[model samples]
Target: MADRDKDSSAESRRILDRIAREADSSGSSLVSRTVKRARDHVSAADVDEKDWVDHLGTRIGRVLGLVICVGLLAWLVMFLVRGA
Candidate 1:
């Protein structure tokens, strides 16, 4: 049991170290990485190629989300400017 625990701990450390090294090598800022991930998600890059309906739905959803975000931001700005 003790040996197993030590082995698991060592494995976890190695995985973390590898991940840190890869991240350093990638040299991408957190914001860029986040944007890339978001773009990929909105584009449904991971969705099945055969699922056209799902792909269309994802795109529509992303567009709606963007519209909603923009609308909310506009409303907030107006509210702040008008002192409401």
Candidate 2:
């Protein structure tokens, strides 16, 4: 049992060290990746062959969806606060 525990601990340490080294080499932080994703989503870069009108509509739709979600969240918070 003691030998097994030692082997497992050493293996776990090695795996964690490799992960840390890879993360350091990649050099892309969480905030930067999040920002890049948001930019791509808002700009609709994933949509292919879209004209200006289509792009504008997509942006508008995204904004409207966001607004609706915020409104709903606010209403929920207010309802909870009021105990209604």
Q: Write the per-residue lDDT of candidate 2 for residues 37-57, one digit (tens) a residue.
A: 987887777666548888788
Per-model TM-score versus the true fold: 0.72, 0.56
List lDDT for all candidates, in order. Answer: 0.89, 0.85
After TM-score superposition, the amount by which residue 13's alpha carbon in candidate 2 deviates from its true location, in angstroms, is 17
User: Residue 79 in model 2: shift from native, Å?
Assistant: 0.9
lDDT of 1 by residue, 4-80 (tens): 99999999999999989767945888888899998888788878869999888988898789889999999999999
Give the range of the ten consecutive residues with the poorest summed lDDT in model 1. Answer: 21-30
The residue ranges of model 2 lying beyond 4 angstroms of the native Cα positions read: 1-26, 48-50
Query: Which regions of candidate 1 are displaced past 4 Å?
Result: 1-5, 8-12, 15-19, 22-26
Task: Report how far residue 63 has shifted in candidate 1, in Å.
Answer: 1.2
- lDDT score of residue 48 within candidate 2: 64
